[model samples]
Target: MKKQLCILLAAFLSAALLCACSGKKPAEPVPAVSAAPDVTSAPDDSGNDPAATDKPSVPVDTSYNPETDADNLYSSANTILIETEDGFYWCSSTSDYLLFYDNWLEEMIPVCSRPECEHFPDNNVCVQNKKCDAYLEAARHPALYNGKIYYIDSNGIPNPNVDGTRLGMRLFRMNPDGTGKEFIKNLFTPGYEDPQWLIFHRGYIYGMSPQTIIEQGEVSGRTSIIAIPIEGDETTFRTIYEIDNQGWGCMRFIGDYCYFWIHYMEGYYYVNWDTGEIIDEQQMGGVALRWNTVTEEIEILYQELLPKDGYFGETAWVERDGTIYVPGGDCLMKIENGERTVVFEFKEEGKHFVAATVSNGIVFARTVPEDFDDPYGKSEFWVCRFDGTTIFKGELPMDWFYESPEFEGLRGKPRYPGFVMTVGDETGLWIEFGAHWRSTGYNEPSADFLVRYDFTEDGGIEYKLYGSYDDIFIEPVD
Candidate 1:
């Protein structure tokens, strides 16, 4: 009996050891987790349509009183709203664009102020009975470069921050205030990709990406330099040039005969968009050739935008004082005398802007941490001056994308600004594509529609409620 008792005690001790082994220091408390980060959803579709409510006609007061309708202002949710029939940002109207934010759905208002409104093509395109609705995305602080509001299609075709579904982005055009819209139908074949290389300039919009859209099994190569006329909806587009298997990034115009680019993703490869010919292919180098209309030929200039060791990634090239400028991994480069000069040095590695542009004397750049959930450093923006001065260092709220510990699921995402473009000194344009994403909430729009913060006599304003500026978007004005 004593022997039996000893064996039982030994078994008990073993069991106790097993239990202790599984405990694991209590798991460091496992901080509460959330679904993915996304804004809340709009309350509900309560549009005051005549067929539904048939209430007395009430005109939208355009008194410019922020104190009365502060909630509608995009400063908190969307400062402006665009009204159209297709739901959000749709239609071929490229003038008289309206911008506005309503109860929850940030609106892309359509303007009927033009003579063409009386005979709008889309008005009767819905067939004899079926109705074709109009939609428009908001275009605040719109910029009219070539008879069209310079805008980008912020469709989340390839949002890299999340998995499962990839959100894609494209460029588009609209009226200055948000009336007319001419969709830039991207020639995306089945397996096509832009690699985030698109920009608008000199009456034409251009970019390059990989594709399998048309000739599916044909090597998946044949990258091309596509050019779309800036003449609105009726504008014809064609593939100006094609590359067998070259990757593309940001591009800059050199002159009538030349264009320049930094392949970015893998190595350095530049192509002349005008000729669709690669100027050169080198594993490592700095001197670049940019063609300026005024100069008329490819000129040798120094470019420090490419990283000798690490990948230079994507960039936005802008012309300033007849010189070319760009932002890269940890520095900003100026291409002047056929050599790159590091005008500004980024403080930290992996902390850089995905895109940039130049307007006035300030260097408008969008800097993000290479690691989305970067733990060691700031994860938001690194806006800097041409002289490398950080003017607006507003913190980006991307943390809402991840939730851990408690559930550890993606919050999906609350709808937020799809793209950000600076129109002027203080005003910027924000686009919401009526984008409904998937997440912890099971496929749905963001939870919080309009974020309410400080309450004035009119309404309160809140931006975080929409989501962080950089999180809800990918790149480009589109």
Candidate 2:
């Protein structure tokens, strides 16, 4: 009778899975023509097996420290990069493999442990060799906390006992050496869309999910902020806040607060999902907000109606010490303890400060023409101390691109240089450089290299290349 009951439960779950998938899109979309089998995993059953609880049984180490900067914490939604004392570990932007960059050596290598592994797919050599221990298929929002690396595998593992059924969007963790990987929990099932902008802090994972709603023959999207404990399952998932309109939401972390910005259309409304209370209703423009991780309270930092030009400007960045830097008309303003002060001002005739980022007692500011036709037009930058002392001011040099040996053969194509200033510190400013492959068409940008501008004591700047993406593009390793 027990065997019959288990079989009946399996059949019922399969039926439910089919019904769920039929009504909504899959949890993570995969290529339809792929030869690889669907990635899925067995649903964790903690009640049946003590070992299946999916929580780490070992005590967490309290000494593990991670960078709390907004740039490092929330680089991108699809990529996972984390810094440690040893080096940087990130999921490969071009493939399903994980890679490590040695800060001292300034070299990148696959995170594989095998001495002679080529880190490539070879079915004949090993079964599904591409899916190695270092492989993170559809990896998102990876974090290093308490000596373990936790991440979500949007492309999940398949259950062997249940055909045509998947566990769907699971959380996992492994050692820094890419060993002892264990499944944590099924975050979301097949019906719900995968979470975005995941953040791990204070023993909980916070994320946002986009919800599609259609009313009166019109379609729109809403965003829901959620939180779940690291040791908990889907049953513990909680919706903290919800917005009534789709918008560009960027989540950043500083100290005990999670800061985010939402640029919505046709105004917006904030709803506290837990209490079913309407929080705020804004008729125009964007809003800056911060949520306290300890108190679970949401606070609005700033909001403004749409400007006549419709440009809402960039989002404000908060420092680790709780200081906020907001971009005013032509100056960068710093707010601390409810006191506002102008840190840097663009005094040029027809230019204004477009964006600014603060890190390690340094402020990097950029200015652009107030009336520019092309969004990618010429822009200048300044590196200054927090006390308003300028260290360097100039436009980034791109002449080295045509002369560098790395772009020797690729120079024949119509390539345009693109640079993104990511972070700055006492050592220098870190910028990521890419090239637009105009020959291929628009939107085809190549990952070129990551460069740093070292600040000399004499106020001179020196360029250093940290890593290059030439191998990934010049020679296809797949």
Candidate 3:
């Protein structure tokens, strides 16, 4: 009987162990670690996190594909509007807010998504209380690349001193929906200014920094091509190429080479900033340079000498296939494979080709009177194929702005149409009319209109009203 009791006790202990094992839950599978670094995880030296602290927690999309990103050809460092995948992202020209246009909804809204959050005044209940996602304190340049929006904020970080001044400019990036805002790097300190021509290409942000150097009672400016890696911290800032005694001019990129112009300031006259005295009076020439992005080598493409009173337009453009186009006095010149060719020469009397640009295999040339002086004077525009076939050659209809029903009250007023952009095959024109005069005795357009023009297949032209500038903003104007 004692042996039987021992056997039953052993059986009961085994059964109890089995029941405990089945009652417990199985462990969850461990998540796989991401290969890309968490750029927002690291804190700065000041022990403060650069990422938005009050931002609502949202899942980040890690499927960024550079190959399918939008090409940022029209947006430049100084441009207010930047094209993105969905629509355009633009900084308010009149405010400190960043706005976005939703193509599907056909509505413009601030980058902030909080329904009850006011964008202004930094109230306790507003989005600006902690930090507004759309607030750009002195927005310098905002660009879109590789599914991210990059921009420079001049007054982003506050100084530790008693005065309420800013420390320096900060580079930042955010998602398309204004979430996951992260600070990339600090560009410069108090004495230095923000760089110009902010462009995000290949995996870096390229810009031109016009730095002023003073040594031994002489003042000189150094224009440098700066490159900063998009995924790097502050230590990755570098000057790829620099030009002494020159200033920054026009810059364009073609493939891996960045084509730009640097003006000569060796003998140019300029007043001293500190003393306000005139310096050298003789003006010099300028040179166009091509910088290789990979090798960081610079090559001079063209050079032109200027007289004391000569005006250098520096109008040049590069195509995607490494073809360069420049407008001379009366002809359009094309350079490819080190071979210079005159694509077209205007033999018309009293007409001079002033500007030339290429878009979607078509060349647009502007011609003006030989004695043209007014900056807003009437000029003729010529649209031609790559083989020099004339598509259309005539002056743009300036009267369309006055005739449009949208500007009913401002009919027959002095209107000026300026080139805005070229989208697909259509060219955009921004019309500015004298609606009111400011307190500074300067006439400014209270309302501006954007119109798009395109030539049809049968040589007919069609004009469409894109939108009004005032319609995109939320604030009311007088």
Candidate 4:
């Protein structure tokens, strides 16, 4: 009896210990995790014609006014919205209404003038049918070009922060308003993974797919750069370049060639798009590069190294009139003949310019103060001519509630602008003010706000807030 009682006590203590050990800490911030990371999911494909399917249409609530209720626009929910290539502040319609992905209702809602309209895929009277259907589980990464719209259609999986199963991705296309829905091809190939890069360039679609190569029964990974001609058959996929052990390289077509790197902050391979010939391969030793049309060669322009604590990252590159500008150690620098000169710098020693963008013959530089209390720093937006002539400088017309929290003895990310790009004459910025650290093994929650900055002729800038969403990437249609 004494032996049995001791055994039972030991078993109970072991069970309690196991339960306590299973509790996990919050996930680390993104960019500190794996070199290659994946985003969200869509809905399952039924293969039925979206128009032929029958479903009741639900009327979207169009009562929210941004101009009046702008202060009350804070929500912790994940909603999707669409932005045009031109960034003209209106959806692709005549009613001047903005289109949004209603999260709770699982349908596309609009702010159009029509009151009796329904936005479901089966409803023929819905106005959004020409641009997007209600049946789309998740349609994202929109690339508009040549009278057609291209996007990734997914299986509407939840928890877009971490990668779920590859339920298959459909590369679909339609008209500007959403009519003439046509299936392009399935992006998912058996045994391949991490379809992260996609762009339309010069009458063709460029993309990268990471494939697991099984060699001698051992598994390895390889990233394949593929090109699909827009006019050619969708079934015909061609490989432009293939590299092994490369992770998340930025690919861009600046001028006469396509520029990309195999790994981060390494050398670049410049290739002529017309012919699959490697024009030049050179190491930049920096985060980004630019094509010098005068010298007919590429130059490593920007190289901003973050601190050792992994709090912040490098900003986007800005180019104008064949000249490139980037954020450097403490100032904005312009690259000339592989040499960088200070284009603009802050007088304060603690302040640093990190993000640079160009639009309408003007270069915009975003700065932040590094006082440790606000390591993410102040969002001071400055504008200048392409020749580095400073014009306008002021703080952005917005306030922050709370920034990302600093871990124990580790730095945290303050409010900072992630991607700054110019779409037509207007500039679009993706800003993150608050980030909730995940309790699981993943990173921070995938949420960010989009802001549009319109620079007027009088040199005054206008700001427009586009709400928040989870991992929505907006691009200008070429």
Scored by lDDT, the top model is 2
How many clashes in each candidate? 87, 4, 0, 11
Instruction: State the displacement of the C-alpha of residue 267, model 2, in Å, after optimal TM-score superposition.
Output: 4.7
Window of ten residues with lowest summed lDDT in model 4 = 17-26
Candidates 1 and 4 compared by lDDT, better number: 4
Between candidates 2 and 3, the TM-score winner: 2
Q: Which candidate would rank higher by TM-score, 1 or 4? A: 4
Off by over 4 Å in 1: 1-133, 136-223, 228-245, 251-260, 265-308, 348-380, 394-478
lDDT of each: 0.34, 0.52, 0.49, 0.38
The residue-by-residue lDDT of candidate 2 on 1-478, one tens digit each, is: 3233323323432232111010000012111111111122112212233244443342222221243222332334344556555456655334456656655445655555544455543211111245355566644566766666677766555532234275546788776556567888766523343455667765666665666777899777665566666775443356655565555556666545566666555544578889899954443345566665543456556554543444333445566656666554456666566445576775767656655665556666676544332323455777776677888777765545655554554323534445443566666766666554333454333445556678788877788665554322322334
Ordering by TM-score: 2, 3, 4, 1
* Alpha-carbon RMSD, candidate 4: 20.9
Candidate 4 Cα lDDT to native: 0.38
Model 1: per-residue lDDT, tens digit, 92-202?
112222322222333322222232232213222112111111233322222234334455544535543334155544456654333445666532212344433334444
TM match of model 3 to true structure: 0.62
- Name the top TM-score candidate: 2
Predicted candidate 4 versus true structure: per-residue lDDT over 372-403, tens digit per residue = 34424456777666566666666665533232
